[model samples]
Target: MSTELVSLDASKLAELIRTREVSPVEVVQAHLERIDAVDRRINAIVTVADDAIEAAKAAEAAVMAGRELGPLHGVPFTAKDAIDTAGVMTQRGSPIFKGRVPDTDATTVVRMKKAGGILLAKTNHPEFSFWIETDNLLSGRTLNPWNPDRTPGGSSGGESAAIAAGMSPIGLATDVAISIRGPAALTGVVGLKATHGRIPMTGIWPRVPRRFWHVGPIARSVRDVALAYSLLAGPDGADGFSTAPLQLDAGVGSSPGRPLRVGWLVDAFAPVDADVAATVRASAEALTSLGIAAEPVRIPVLEEINALELLWKLQVMETKPAFRKVTAGHEDKIFKHVQGVYDTPDTSIADFVDAEQKAEQLRDGFAAYFQRYDALICPVTTVPAHEHDAAEFDIDGQKVSSLHVMTATAPLSVTGLPGLSLRFGTSREGLPIGVQLVSPWMAESTILHLASLLEAVSPVRGLHPDMSRI
Candidate 1:
């Protein structure tokens, strides 16, 4: 019964609650019970909300009173620990901020609750949301629900695992480079990182490098993400970046009047795993099969910029100061992953300026690429979910540093473009593989429209990780 309750996407759950077919309390309790039963295997949820059942009760009372409901009314959702939740312990996966509780929700969290989505729990992450795998001094580590030996991906790893393991139908997650997309791909779920400014970042921590940070929804289905995006987007006047004047149309169960031109690039991040490469190709082929004009294409700046390095260089210049301030007199609280950042040499003035210039050019390059195609399909990571704390990755033939995992997704992060990650294939070991759908900044609808169509034809659409072993 708990499994069935937790399986419905947030959109369906909201509809069920709205019609009185299911009580919000039943929905919330089922998730809570599921987490209690399975979170032991994943370590994904660190703090279960003490008042989740009470919130569900309040939602039920409103329904009984015939109150008008918000879009997500009565749906339970989890938030990455890095995002603020009023009166909830948002320790940020660190002992430095142990017991820290925010006085208000982040803008995205505020919107989630405003839509009647009850806060269910806070998931784990790397300390300060910095690592490639979700292990920290505070909450330990999060494991992939598909296999215990494999990682769930980082920063937003716990959030992804919880949703994949059926502990939550959907969640709120943040991404600077690949937090949302990578983790979702590593697990088997759908995650959207909207155009940088489309969703406000107010009330989220580690605000340095603010322009690259995006808050969006991670769910089990495309329509649920679209529903969450509609509720979460728009300016709250608190964040300068959140000034997008237009709203996303979603365009679900619909298509554009013209044939949607599509492009796919796999070799740009050469040495990509054969499985990952095929998944990207399959995505493009799926689009072509639908009568969309699809073909191989490249954005020159991806090769020129080496975005994985550029993102680190650009972010280090801004992140170090914030780190110093937070860990001042508390250096003992720091973790190795974060300590590595402090050990890396600071960018020179010339190098920093050069990176900033390259970033603008990267954006221009993607703008030009989008002019030829409405959406681009690419690999979200070089390989499927790997084992935990590996020193390096073996991509195809060549062994590369762990950072290579971000090579495919970092370009979009640097450009502030909207991207979505959804499962389209499975690896030899049965791990889920995802493809990324990207579009020009603020035109999330185009990417999402393409995503919904791809989802319809996805070979692995309804496949879930076999969690029974764990």
Candidate 2:
């Protein structure tokens, strides 16, 4: 019974708590038991909150007193370690910040708590949340729940893994260049990266290059993601970039008159796995059954665009120096890939200016495309989850750079558009394949509406990783 309780989504859990069917204490205890049983093998959760049970007791009292509850009352959620949690260790997957506890919570964390959600644990991430895999010098590697030999995807990999394995029903995640969406794709869950300013990044690390960083929700269902987003979206005054107010209408895409026009692309990047491509096409076809006009459209910028090149250039010129200043004497403590950023040659002001110009062009291009289409559908990664410690892998008999994992996602990162990744299907190996649905800035509702529709027919829906092997 506890195992089944942990497996339900946040919405159902909240409903159970609202009525007399279940108490907050039982829900929290069930998840904690689930974590103890499985987290040893998955290694997704890094720090379990010490006060979680006490908080659950209080929440149970509130229910017993017949108090009004918030939308997520009594539901437990995990957070990526990159986000701040008051009195909880947020190591950011780096040893340098080990034992560091913030005096205050991040805006998202505070809002989640205010909405009656309990912070059960902090999930793992790569060092500084910089790498595509979830391994750091602090908490070690987080193995995929689906296949223990493969990664869960990162830097939000741990969040995805925990939710997928039923350690937590929902969680918060950060995304810059596929950190959130990529992991969701690999783990067969739902992840959202709303418009850049939709959620405040007040307490998240690496606040430099603020234009690309976004805080969003990762959960088993799109409605839960939407529920979390509604509570977390707003300006917090501390993050200057989070000034735009989101206008979300519950009925935006529900009207029969508002039929969606979606554009589908299977080859947004090179060396896409055949199965992954087929899943993207299949997702588009599924949308067609719901009165969506799914069409094959090409965005020319993607053909010539090197997303990583632009990303590295921008980071080297704008964000790297600021990061270096913060971690000056702790060079040896940082992850090797992150240290390589400091070792690499710095970009000139001319090159930096050129990259910024090109980014604007890409954003403009996507904006134009949105004018013709409600959303664009594409692969989240070139292949499904790969083996651990793999620097490079083969796709369709062709050896490709390991960085190809970021190929489909980095372009959207540059554009600061809203993107959501949801489980579309599975690979021949029984691994999950996710497709990204992207829309113009501040148009998260459009993509989410489409995602909710896809969720209704997803082949991998209600599927859980077989943990008995672990």
Candidate 3:
């Protein structure tokens, strides 16, 4: 077997496995062996499924018996610790849920399993899925596969790291506020945070009061993201919040049959690093190459969305009891910055109502902006991947937490619009940097279509970190 098995795209692997050109067992074993060899260095995987091999064996039997295959048939994948998996320890990277096991798979997990995806393992996350860096009491920290000392981006950090290192072909991740996209940007992967509730958030940890929370996929390519999205999307009777399926096409770029008008938000309510700005600009430039018109537009209201200080406070107020038990004398051990959010008082009813109204207004404004442009181009983060333990950092002279610094990412979250994080290029320091492609609500296919074209023009898919480089 070649050591390069991990380098192949998930779609190619699934096709070969479905056609009997490669056995599912062989594919699973190759990834398992790769995990054994590389996971120690990155600490991305937590609990490897005990029956993974057996699961692969069974999947192989189905293939041999001429069973119809799903798009992702026989492909191996992993999920963030925040998503519940039946019979597996979903520790949530905290000592509180250490042995907690769900009797039923999460809505997304069950769908993926039914689609012929083998559950390989569970990846790491911040305690309670709270931070942009994946570290907690139970599982330690998940290091960036590119630069071990730098962060992999969280709470889907582990999912991003694992996929970047080739431990899994595709990863199931969550994105409350760039948790999926940020990690994808930092780790050189493709992550899509579809419109709110497009994928059910049932069984995910830290159930916040707001619908800003989203579950998405982090994968090696755009097609893999589409396949994962197709399986994970649609209405699950268990989740009533999931909106009726919009007429959204999430596949590759199709001829929109009209001239594409794109709104480029260069300064997305936050000061971006020089290299980060350049990376996004280059991507916008690439779009123009294909006859797409790019117009600079300002989203001033974007700054208001990142003032989530009050939002986090309300979340803490609601989940105080559950979090207290999880922290049990370990409050100091948790990320100090994260714990501080809870230290603030809860959002008063008046404040909550005011924010909701304001948020709706912001959504209306963006919808109007989208009326003029097919998509919005912006930065995913103010900077590229920071040091692994980066809690506080200086961005354009403002001292901010990793969470607040990602103001560029919050507008889409607050507006409940779909955003795709596309790896554009690396920083001068050789760290991965990506651009955010935003489309109107439920227009995931439109954003993805533009992303596919950008990806084809200036493909940054070449920079996967070989953790074994050392």
For each predicted model, how many residue pairs clash, with residues at least 3 apart or on different chains?
Answer: 0, 0, 1
Q: Model 2: which ten-residue window has the lowest total lDDT?
A: 246-255
User: In angstroms, how far off is 445's CA in candidate 3?
Assistant: 0.5
Which structure among the candidates has the greatest lDDT? 1
lDDT of 2 by residue, 131-238 (tens): 889998899999999999999998899999999999999999999888999999999999999888889999998886778898999999999998888899989989
Model 2 alpha-carbon miss at residue 339, Å? 1.6
The collision pairs in model 1 are none
Write down the TM-score for model 3.
0.94
lDDT of 3 by residue, 1-470 (tens): 64666788789899898779888899999999999999989999999999899999999999999999877788899999989999988987777567899888888888888888999999998887777788887889889988888898877999999998999999899887678999999988999998888888888877764477889889988888887887888777766678657456532346656787787876755567788888877888888878887767886666445435544544555666657666778766566545765676777888777776777777878877876777889888888899866667786687777665467776667667888998998888888888999887777877778887877876566667867752
What TM-score does each of the candidates earn? 0.98, 0.97, 0.94
lDDT of 1 at 385: 96
lDDT of 1 at 73: 89
After TM-score superposition, the amount by which residue 172's alpha carbon in candidate 2 deviates from its true location, in angstroms, is: 0.8
